[model samples]
Target: MKHSILLVEDEQKIAEGIMDYMNGGEAEYETCFTWADDGDKALELVYENEYDLVLLDIMLPGADGFEICKAIRAKSYVPVIFLTARGREEDRLYGYDIGCDDYVVKPFSMAELSAKIMSFLRRSKGLWEKKSSIEAYDIVIYPDKLQVFVAGNEVRLAPKEYAMLKYFMEHRGMLITRDDLLVRLWGYDYEGSDRVVDNHIKKLRQALGEPGKKIKTVFAKGYRMD
Candidate 1:
């Protein structure tokens, strides 16, 4: 799936380079951008649709990135990263004060920027952790950061997939029926086939890869993680 990002920068060439480099970059998950060269246009697009992430420049045409960030924070929890030439310690702190998920100074490495974007996206979707790590087999779940590791390599999963993994790990060895999953995870109001549980579980297992064998299928019933 493509990660939708909003790039709000005034410089023409820099914006183009970012869009081209990031869109063409080899990422675990692809990234696509909607470019807004000025702050007014950025806010306009922000109001138009929801984005997975926003890359904002501090100095802009209409409202500054900080103002845009404040407006964004007032309504949405989407991850915002400040992309600016300002490298002062105070500036970085203020950006953080205004709910900036990350601060990237200008003339930065595109590869490093790409990594930061992916990390934030993972954090945003991995439920942004709090608790300590939970381990089973070679799979480790860190609720503190909401990160998963398989054989010590970090793995990123969609929110639902992460939830399914956690639930399975928590209820290891128990016969969890599809209906149970539907009610507990998908909610009682979910109007869909119980097969949706299977589909999610399939994706979850695929994410786990070789370690996925830890999640056992219980013929026609649901699943067991042991």
Candidate 2:
């Protein structure tokens, strides 16, 4: 699959250069680049389409890259890299504080930036592979097939229920909030209430039978798969 990236940079020349380098066949995987010249447009694009990674410039017309990164983090776990001319120690620290996966300074070599992107991509791929299929508590989950088996017995589940279960299994020990599930599974455009998450979780647990006890509910919080 071709990985899509959103490049949010105000400088047209710099943006084009980065695009050329990324599309120049340096990486092993195919890449599709989408450019956003302003911060507002960047935010709009992120909400409209899913991206594998985001390259943001610190300086922008409508909003700064830091603000954009913060907004993205609030909704999604997409990898973000700050490509900016601001190379100060405090600036880099702030970028990390706001959850940027990587920070690259201006005048950076395209080769180095490309390597950084590839590294993150590889790590993301590894995580996906690790979570793709998991066997726990006598329950087996095949995320790609959307199938779940308990003690060798196939369990039928609705589409949403399957997705919710897969997400819970992937993040087994994490305290996943309802908003996190909404954003990860339903996307930012979902207009439904948070109660939808609760309903799905209930159905998912019921479908898995005895093994479903691994999915624990934290009162006033969200569900967690043990």
Candidate 3:
């Protein structure tokens, strides 16, 4: 089956290139490329169409990426990939804050874009099919709705924190590395330090309480929730 994609970009050339690569190629998955030059139209398309993924350019004509992302998050968690100019830390953070699933700076390679698309698709599939409520001993993960409730009380978690915890729960007892977490949670263009992962883990542990120590840190490696 072809996976539908909503591509919002004002640039014609770049948009064409992406469409050709994604839809014109002979890949394992099929892609339906839908384009929008502005935010208002993008929002319309989102509500009107059933897209599995959204490739959003931050700078739009009518509506900006941030606004579009916020609107989308209000209704759906369909994976959102932000396309913007590099070196805009604030913009990238804003995208993530508004529930963006990934970020890719401008002038990026088509291969990189395709790889990121596939990665998110895989992650989304895994997340959607997850049990409605995840209970690994005392650690509970509500994968279906992107919520975490530990020990009967819902624990508010950041986007990255939720992704991290979900990954750990899905692969319990596995030794996840900083690189692994960075790539999986933040994607290829992640600029923050691995310390971010540590901080989130610390927060997760604290929220889990009681058996918070269950998330063992493997010295110089990473962490595992066992």
- State TM-scores per candidate: 0.56, 0.57, 0.67
In model 3, which residue pairs have backbone atoms overlapping below 3 Å? 39-63
* lDDT for each residue of candidate 1 in 1-226, tens digit (9 for 90 to 100): 7888899999999899888887784565788799998888888888888788899999999989998999888767677889999998668767765667677998899888888777667646434232366677898898658899999999999988897887666545657677667765666556789888888888888899988988888898878887
Q: What are the runs in model 3 whose C-alpha is more than 4 Å off?
A: 126-140, 143-226
lDDT of all the models against the reference?
0.80, 0.80, 0.77
Q: Candidate 1, which segments miss by more than 4 Å at Cα?
A: 126-226
Candidate 2 structure quality by residue, lDDT tens digits, 96-214: 66667677999999998998887667546445336556677887887668778989998988888877776665455657777667766776556789998888887877888887788
Clashes of each: 1, 0, 1
Please give the lDDT score for candidate 1.
0.80
Sorted by lDDT (best first), the order is 2, 1, 3
